[model samples]
Target: MDTDAILALLDGQYLLILGAVLLIIALVAIIKLRGSVHQLGQEHDQLTRRLDTLWHDLDAMHQDDTPSLSGKSKAPTTSATPDTSPELLLAERRLFEGLWPVAWALHDKVGGFLRAVESGDPHSESRLAARNAALEMRSQINRSRPFFDAEIEGILTQLVDIEIKAHLTACQYLDQRQSNLGVSSEGSDVRESYRNKWRQLYDREANELINHLVSAMRKRLVRHVP
Candidate 1:
């Protein structure tokens, strides 16, 4: 085959791989969302069963004049916050997993805009949307960081920092593009910077943290199931 044909084939393969990744991210988002709902349902069912058993025990105790021991669980602790519930923690982990899909989608949007600018179209609405999404995701991370363990929080803070930088570059690029002024010379550099950030988030730093959290959460969550 000629060199040109080989290059074209390689490009096609690269695109196929990227498409597969995007599809996987979309599926993950759906699965994690479902997992959160399912865990909630399980916890709710357990709570109802426990309540019913307590009521029955109370009735029997009244008739027999004996103490009730219907529930096998420990007495209530001072902290009844959802934070202490295993099901809620699992749901929280799944919910945290759900955020990455949005981050990946925003990565894709920024990538597309980078390509457009490279082809001389200047940055477009897509990049602006990506910037906004990154900002919103950062806000979400802030609200959620406290719920997680310290290790996870450390990874998340880094992710938020990257988001801030990426968004600032995007904002500046869009402003320059909208003015009659041509695309800035720094556009290529910023594009490269975001590409690195994407890799760090999905393939390296954030990926490792996600695996750890998932493993820890699953173990604890199973113990709480009725």
Candidate 2:
């Protein structure tokens, strides 16, 4: 072949090689991008589910207007005559009215946290709302600190710990689930391990702790005559 013709043929071969390399690079980029898009879709779907669950929980709490934890549905009516001892009367009123509602509020708060777990929704706002309500109840107890002695305070502290632990457990479970889902190579055994830890350790421990607090509180309150 002539010199110019040989050089032209070499140029054509170089162009073909370069085109192949570019095509391979484009395919790899597309694959990576598709995987990312799929991941984003999954994340969006999970968030949407969480939001829906939170809305449902809020609706349920709003609907349940009946008093909880209190033994009676309505307060007993008294004669028009007022009590002679104002202090005793106030204590009596608090025993009947304040304490029961506070207990019920705590119960409701726990129930809400459990429901959020059942729903598998970690909507921050819903969890925050429940936490804030629990805090308010805690504040009320603190304000009435003198009424409850050392033993009562200890039980209340235990109850607060239970509440805080429940929230932490739920958040940890959600985080683990999300992390497991993000990794493509994660094995079923790892997921199962997470489940076991949550069920056997986190949940069982929290349940036992809360039950202990409830029993302690009941025992302490039982001794009070007023």
Candidate 3:
């Protein structure tokens, strides 16, 4: 072939090769882009599901805070009964609102402390928090004594006592466990078993007491509704 013709042929081949390389690069980029888009879509779906779960949890909490009254519905009474006077009812409602959060706080704190003890690494922060919660609960009850009837007040006292006992028992368990960390003896096993039994018993009792307290409070509130 002529020199110019040969050079022209080589240039055409080079252009074809460059175009092929560019095409492959574009295809690879497209594939990678598709993968990134798919990954983002999956992440978006996961986040949306998490948000939905959070919303559901919040709604459930709201429902728990404001329980509906069960059974008989009577017409609103025209005159204020001595016990159900508007002022007294308002005060009782406020007390209920104030006490509810503190009660649950104490319950959660004690429960957390017990769980931490069971896990064999009870955090000091958890213990202190539980103790403070108990004290706060007692103080709150005492402060609101005027709003509570004798029955409710008694229930509150019982709840506080049981919670304190549970907290103390948990602390003792942790202390014993720490003191005997390297020891392995039959007596140790027996003591461990005994502690476990008491812990379980206290936890069960506390749960029951909390349920009873809640039911009593609900009934008290419902009773005075005009």
* Candidate topping lDDT: 3
Model 1 gets an lDDT of 0.54
- The CA root-mean-square deviation of candidate 1, after full C-alpha superposition on the true structure, stands at 28.1
Sliding window of 10 residues with minimal summed lDDT for model 2:
69-78
> How many residue pairs clash in each candidate at the backbone level?
0, 0, 0
Sort all candidates by TM-score, best to worst. Answer: 3, 2, 1
TM-score of 3: 0.58
List model 2 lDDT by residue over 190-218, tens digit each. Answer: 54554454454335544554465455446
The true-structure Cα RMSD of candidate 3 reads 15.1
Question: Higher-lDDT candidate among 2 and 3?
Answer: 3
- lDDT against the true structure, each candidate: 0.54, 0.56, 0.68
Q: Compared with the true structure, what per-residue lDDT tens digits does model 1 show for residues 144-193?
A: 76565544444444443443344444445444555554355575556556
CA shift at 32, candidate 1, in angstroms?
A: 62
Per-residue lDDT of model 3, residues 35-138, tens digit only: 99999999999989975764454343323322232311112223222376768777887888888899889889878877777776637788778777876887
